[model samples]
Target: MSSQPVPCKNLHEWLSFLEGLHTSEIDLGLDRVLTVFRDMNIGKIAGCVILVAGTNGKGTTIAAMEALLQSAGKSTGCYLSPHIHFFNERVRIDGRNMSDETWVEAFERVESHRGQVSLTYFEFTTLAALFIIARQMPDFALLEVGLGGRLDAVNIVEPDVSVITSVGLDHQDWLGEDRESIGFEKAGIMRPGGVCVYGEVNPTKSILQQASAQNVDLRVFGRDFGVLDADSEPATETMTDSPVFLAQNSAQQPIPDAPVPVSYQMADGDFVRTVLSEQSIPVSNRLCAIQALALTGVRLDKIDIDHCLSLISVPGRFEVDKNNPKYIYDVAHNVHAAEYLSRLLQATRQRRRGKIVCLFSALKDKDSKGIVSLLDKTVDSWAGWPMQVDRALSLAQLTAVLGDNATNAECLPTLGEAVVRAENIACDRNDTIMVLGSFYAVAEVQSFLTNRANRSRGVDEKGIEV
Candidate 1:
């Protein structure tokens, strides 16, 4: 719709322009992007940039990084993709969404540099994020690769420490069909002499091979460093009363029962075992973030890190919005994530007295069948809806993949309708409801629950008191 180097007055305008800039939604490679990156001349950012790549757990890892870094009083700029609600949430500095003016300026800078190369939406956004981060010069610029790492726009920047959160079968058309192929693509973020951390319990062979060939100091999760000990504390009165999301009150000490104390060893042979009371970030994800931070030469005191853990919050990852019915929302689309969600749901089911109600939707490109298959046994009843997106796997297609269990699955007209139907069928307020499949599904479910919660509080949809 527009030529390179065109000016945009606002963030919305820039986004609209970017959508039609390139012929296709995804064009993976670096030659054209590299040329434009050099034109932007963000060669030496004043701060350190940590590039994180993987199939799942990438968001969780970066979330912990941001919270921990900010807790230590370091200015941080983080770039994430496919936001749930707001676009500004994708780019944050000091844990706050960047203003519209800041994003517009960054987009203009990137537009000014592209000579004749046609950059995809993700590529264009990547450059803009880097430009903004460089201008601010935060203590650390955390970049989450939009897709498979090697040719992804963020890979153009050299990261002091690269982390592969976990690899799985996703984006098979571009990343290959198996874990080996996908791992190689993600490992492309690693640089020679740079440190790389593998957070997957069993990393792919290709990942290990590529990092070793690059002479990277590869830290393996099980061998190099593993979670030694971890135990969960009991819930508190505050949490018991609210039961949805408990914000960290600076004046209060963490409830002894809320802490999920975990022990792990780092590359320095130093053991780091601390309690993460906040369910916002899981124990495994916390370990990944801690290792990445440690690699950055940031000496963290056990007490300090533990204290900051209370402040960590990652939206849409097992986000509990209602305690009575145990309504939880998570963006777990792939098989690896499904396994994690299954375990989480299983544990949650054991603690409660009712069956689980799963409201789900997924993109056609994802392993929708595998994901549904993993959660099928754990879920008692399924309520699914059609996603109004380009790559949405139709209700019929999903049912076919779900196999014999298709008999039990009910498809609704829209995601919103599915949410209502799920809540109605969840037995009562004591039963559990899980909203999963994709970020789109979780986002919509969250809105539904939020609106309902407001109504219950006697507030109208317009935020007016009844």
Candidate 2:
């Protein structure tokens, strides 16, 4: 390692320095990273930590939990991977980005504690986030897994609750080649006597096996507690078509009968209620977070939960920018995420008149073909870009994956140019634009859109109001 002060006298410099170290993109061993943590005495810190891992819905789940906790007046710290717009967005306390001085101090602390053991860029950054969390000593710390759970650096922390939110085929090269293999890796996040929550309705057998072997208290969505309908009202008629039930009994509880056809809003509310109740969480939003927090014995009222859920927001995950074409941005790069996006698009299509234009790109490591094939039928127009990020595929590779599709597929060298082209093509007021594929692609387009919106709002070129 360079052992030098990060450049630019800012948090960005520290991030840049960390990124510059180690040519390897991913080193899945724990010894080197553990040594740095052990040397820094991070394990001795006082805080309730929750580690979230899985192929899809992890970010959304984390955001909901964080928001619920914050609403309850808890001092919260959240660390997310592969930032969307700014590196600072990765490490946040109570929804605010960390300061430059905080980053410098944390980097110095990690460097001082390291004794001969080398750390990868991720390891270094993970340690920094831990250092910040330890210092802040927030009521709770939410750590999003950078990759698979077992050997990931975040595994070092013995969380009170380990949540695996819907496993799928992602990171096949390192985790495994199939769903079972990926489930095993995600199961690594569970600790002895710790509570394990599976957001997926039916997880693979391997995940259950690993949890049983670890003797972790496992909570599966459909089997444990469940959601059911209580009663129907006209006000909630359009919200949900079906009334969901939260069954407390795990054994021999017959599934509830399907409700009369109703509105989409009621159906969604029913689903949310089912999920929250199945997890043994209270009906209120504060309880939504408190359910997860209850594993650690923290209790809060409904008002508190409502407060937290209202304040928390997960960026670039279902974030919509109200431009002329009305861009909907999400960081859905994998197949499961693509499926979710497909559902969202389908729902929007019911009310909207214009075609949905998709701007897509991804790293070479991802299952590009499978993801594209799934999206091919959903999107009306396709714009591809291969920006020079780590392991980003070239335009040729992206075009080859499209393979002469009927959709309007074009290769744009840069994300900025791609967004401009997409906007121009989506000139009609009824059209909607979606930019996705990689977090980097989403971030690049977000910056462009934010600037464009600012310009339209009469903000000066320098990003300041007149």
lDDT by residue (104-143, candidate 1, tens digit) is 8888777777867898999988888888788888999888
Going through the candidates in the order shown, the clash numbers are 3, 21
Worst 10 residues of 1 by lDDT: 236-245
The number of the candidate with the highest lDDT is 1
- Candidate 2 local Cα displacement, residue 358, angstroms: 0.7
Predicted candidate 2 versus true structure: per-residue lDDT over 215-316, tens digit per residue: 887866544323333453313212223344333322123322332211111101222221221111112222223345545554433443333444444677
State in Å the error of residue 195, model 2: 1.0
RMSD of each: 7.5, 6.7
| Candidate 2 Cα misplacement greater than 4 A, ranges | 1-9, 229-290, 304-312, 322-325, 404-406, 451-466
Model 1, residue pairs in steric clash:
5-111, 233-257, 234-257
